[model samples]
Target: MSDVTIQGNILTPAGWLSGAISFGERIAGIQGAAADPQLNGDDYIIPGFIDLHVHGGAGKDVMEGGDAVHAIARIHARHGTTSMLATTMTAPPEDIDLALTAIGKAVRQRGKNEARVLGAHLEGPYINSGKLGAQPNFARAATLAEVQRLETMAPLRVITVAPEIAGHLGLVRELADEGMRVQIGHTLGSYEDGVAALEHGAAGFTHLFNAMSGLHHREPGMVGAALAHAEYAELIPDLLHVHPGAIKTALRAIPRLYCVTDSTAATGMPDGEYMLGRHTVHKCMGGVRLPDGTLAGSTLTLDQALRNLVGLGLDLADASARVSTHAADYLGLQERGRLVAGAYADLVVLDRDLKLKAVYIEGERCDLNDA
Candidate 1:
């Protein structure tokens, strides 16, 4: 394939560049590009944001068919996310299959809109029922055969399960060996049990401190263990999923701190009713929830998450690391999530005010303001 270069003020691993980069059609290196298109940078040029967890946006849910999925992807891409893992909340196994298979196809088809689909993050249907929060309790804990069937569905990247479930640890290791990230979340497990799963290769925590137990001096729950274990913790920084103070606290507690946006289908839309999995959540003021008003998912976009970080007194470099650099490291996507030479030309440009200016996904200008 021929190269389509993007020459602009660049941001490399070393730092911002005074010149630009030669982006190729499936970028290999500078020589990879057939032609170099210069994009003069009056804006901030950084690697495109990668969202590891998100449901939907732009008044559409990923669970809806093609149009909705593609539309949601476009909406996020315009806002600076070049790629994302389409996350599925707890739902029936049949629905899970449909969503997973559809997402796999979307990734392969390269979404009618430009945001690349990394894979799918099946956040439930494998979690504990007793501890279930926003997720429908009826959609909890599938049999082993049910969970195993997912290996054939999509590139299952991350699965959130409660380790305390019987036969869960075995399943955890099973998923870990299959190259899927096993994250302990939406559970009520003791510190020892949580640590044991981590020792057995459970590598992440989902939306820390929300929909889970709180830390205690005597009973140190999952939150306590996650805080104690510095190397792992992917907290959602939407401020609603967690309070601002708690967001600061978790960052200080964890050594390898990172941010994730558990954005629901209602993100970037007017507040109202929306469906997530088997339950319908009421949306208002950027928060999604169930009928009884229990907080479900969030209405946070990657842009808003970054803006929140800035508002919380974090500098662009530090905030960018948590949102972009650190998250890529956690997912072990060796080549993505950074602005470096030879890396994929997945980039986003923003104004000094931090508003999204444009985006390039794998060298294609998802937005063409500069053109």
Candidate 2:
């Protein structure tokens, strides 16, 4: 028997479709023509947004503990992010372990609230110091032993490493062989280095255009390489990470640009002083900036990214592919991200205006009408 039947516009797993999804606790089933649960005739159902590059939100850091992960995750869940990876910045090896350990625990343990923790994304410590956006330089470019230690800690679904960093690219292959997705980021590598690393098994790009090389005609740096490998690129389209026009150009070149908020502790907090580990980041204008005006993480939400990218005139199916569908396939998550029968009924119900109506973490619903 179905526990809850949500009608309205349901974003199904197959794609954004109009149907009723009935579930008991977690996703039990997708209610269609043959199910007891009925749906509203015309509500927009979208798969809950999946953020692969989020650090913290709702004034809590994921590194704190399961409580903190739950707190931050619940807040993003309100925004329709049914699943997320708790990302970590470049910190000491011990600190990274703490965060990853916490996330690993969260993934194994479920609560009555919060989005599902699919896995972890180590965005730093292994990254190049040169491309460290706001990560402390003290703990940069550790040896392969250190990288392997972090990789094997839990299930490292995604690791951000610099290809040009001392033998890091080789480790990228090992991680890939272990069925982990490796991304290239935080580096000063040339185009050739990025291309070679891709040949070594790097499947995606992390927060493209932030703390990485800019595209130059002659150099055609990492940014250029990502653009060249459109089918294999992930980008943060918050306008702060990459310019709007640049986002447009890259979208034209790259077919599979995914959107990530890369939000930090200051994300849901006010525009004042906020903590990002040992450093303090301030929200200025619409973006976060370090003490010296370097771009720290952002406070953007995925809903905002979808509206912005859609405003850029991309097709709806293609844009949907970039966020919900493509992100799932990228992480090799077979069950969720697409709305279909016998799949996890984790999704977001939005209005025609693209604002969130109600968000479902698994089958539980949270009203976002006030948000």
Quote each prediction's TM-score. Answer: 0.90, 0.90
Clashing pairs in 1: 48-347
Looking at model 2, residue 3 earns an lDDT score of 72
CA lDDT of 154 in candidate 2?
A: 55
lDDT of 1 by residue, 33-100 (tens): 22221333355667778788888887777666555667767888877787888888787667777788
Q: Tell me how far the alpha carbon of residue 9 in candidate 2 is from the true structure, in angstroms, after superposition.
A: 4.7
The list of candidate 2 runs beyond 4 A from truth reads: 8-19, 25-41, 142-144, 367-371
Candidate 2 per-residue lDDT over residues 237-275, each given as its tens digit: 777778888888877886667888888877667778776
The lDDT values for all models are 0.75, 0.75
TM-score of 1: 0.90
